[model samples]
Target: MERIRLTGAQATMLATLYGKAMDARSPNSVLHDTMALEAVRRIDHDFSKVGIKPGDASTVALRSLHFDGWTREFLAAHPEATVLHLGCGLDTRVFRVDPGPGVRWFDVDYPDVIDLRRKVFPEREGDYTLLATPVTPAGWLAQVPADRPVLVVAEGLTMYLREEAGRELFRAIVERFPSGQLVFDGFSKRGIKLQKVNKAVQVAGATLYWGVDGPAELESIHPALRCVSAVSAFDLDGFDRVRLAYRLLAKAARMIPVMRRMAIMYRLEF
Candidate 1:
């Protein structure tokens, strides 16, 4: 099969898929995304350029674990809630979670990406909907059900967006829903700098434009939003010299706010 060529931002989704696939193959993996593993095998692109070393793949697996756990909890609490997965690339989350009959799940991304997803992924079951549109402060949200609680997940996305764009997106989401939860990851300025040279990012031609130190600053982006919790990549369970470094950095970041910017898993409520 001919390989699909994607824009840098679009290709970042491939990076996460690679991570999930690699993790699934690991013996004691945090995320067992068999779907992701399959997707990686089906796609005919050179994944090595994503510069995902063993440590980096482990980090990606941990991040996937965090998002998966968070979403499961949310669905358990609000079985009938609407789930809006923004910038959802080729991720097989819907199949993995299987939110059942009551939940309304939406997977959204660029029109081209969604088209590719439809071809590669299995047909949707139940109340699953796919929206192909740019995720911004515009037409897309109007189509979503506003009355029910919303669980929004934006993975491997914000770093490519400008600060104002990120602010506008969250603000729009908060404004549309009566109440809900938003889970995403944010990197610090230093991390953005590192991404420029990252093999995968460079190969994908994606650029990192934004970073934040903590959830408090993001809370300022929208009045209704409040920080619930924030965890560092190092705070997750793992044993490695790099993981130890992250653990130590996470602890130190608590003392020094700037250090907190390294990488964060944030849960916010409105």
Candidate 2:
């Protein structure tokens, strides 16, 4: 089979589908919930036309929802705060969160993704801008106003970065903005090792290169960095219709703690 350059929307579609596949039984799970699932279904249909198979499609979909939930929660409290979504892909978070009139939102990604996004979504005049540039390069920070409070979110992008680069990115955000918050998903060291053996991960072009054993690991990156919360699918609350087996597994993972090595979202305040 020939290799295809998957667009950001295509990758996001896969992440959403993966979440739906894993938690299809949980009515409260984002994948099992409302409009987001419908969006995922639409993306999956598009992926099918492009010859993307079900398994790969689902993995990306799950990852998208996982980050989407975290991003939505953070934006809820800081609606007025500026939101910088790194490696945003084609996720409709700005619409999902609906920052209203005052909040400033910037979606940063590679040029190709931005190009496609403009065509796919309507361009609103105020409160949003699509930035087409590599996030790692310097000078992009100047574009954002340092006066307002900021929240930087990195969803599925961190795992692809090396440890030093990730740390530098964290430091840069803290240094650039006077005060803000960050929420990003990270894998544990064991998770990194396991990915090497997981054929499923290999097929998706994913590798768990960055890992944080616990909150302290994130805090150690900078003294100003404070871990407000760490969450896993198992830690999520408010599910009325969870299955017995799944509930048991989630509870067991929390009790053991070691099971958190799989994947956890870290919320940091600076």
Candidate 3:
């Protein structure tokens, strides 16, 4: 494959794919995203520049597990619901989740990223659609059907956007869908600061723009939305061996007020 020049946000797709690929190879992996592994093998880029360290791969898997778990719960409640995967990279989440025949799924991202996805993955028409558009400014939201309850998910996104832009994006989703849920992972102020020196961010040349100290504060983004739950990454399960590592570090982290607010996952309803 020829090398592709990508902006910071677009380059992030590669890092995420690397992380998922690493998790899939692990014996005790939680995400098991084989598609990601295959996609990485087929892509001709030098993945070494992405800076996906072993611990970073574990973090990605843990976050993916949270989103996957929440999605399953939502689908169970509304089997016919439409699922919108915001900033859908080459992670192959649809393949991993397999929401069954009743649901319609749309993967939205930048046009170039979507083009790459089409080339690498087998096309699944009718039930699955690949949409290419900028997530913020949200012009693409008009294309998604809003009549049915929707489950919108954004993983490893949001942090790259300014607070105002991120709020507009969330507000658009809540306004477009009469009833739905929005799930996403966000960094705290401290996380944003730490990201500046994070190897992956350094390699990708990306900036972390938005971070929330408390996940519940995301509710302020839109009047129609309310936070269902906000939990720390350390509180969630599926960490496997890392759970112990997190616990041991928990006390040390708490000593630093900023580190305590590093990462969190949120479930919200509108």
Cα error, residue 90 of model 2, in Å, equals 1.8
lDDT of 1: 0.81
Candidate 2 C-alpha lDDT tens digits along 1-270:
112355432244344433444344343443443443444444323433332343333334455555666666666776677889987766666765667676899999878767756655557667898889877754687898877778888876676667887888888888888888888888788777776655434545555577778899899989999998788746654322345655567677777777855778788999
Q: Is candidate 2 or candidate 3 better by TM-score?
A: 3
How high a TM-score does candidate 3 get?
0.92
Please name the candidate that would achieve the greatest TM-score relative to the true structure: 3
| Per-residue lDDT of model 3, residues 118-209, tens digit only | 88887774589899888988888888888889999888888888999998888888888879998988898878888867777888888898
Clashing pairs in 3: none
Ranking by TM-score: 3, 1, 2
Q: Write the per-residue lDDT of candidate 1 for residues 1-270, one digit (tens) a residue.
A: 437878778887877888778878877677788888887777788877666755566667777677888999999999889999999998888888889688999999999899888877889779999999988755789898888899999877888888898888888888888889999988987888778567777877888988887777889998888999788765765534234665565567667755555778889999
CA shift at 171, candidate 3, in angstroms? 1.1
Give the Cα lDDT of each candidate.
0.81, 0.66, 0.82
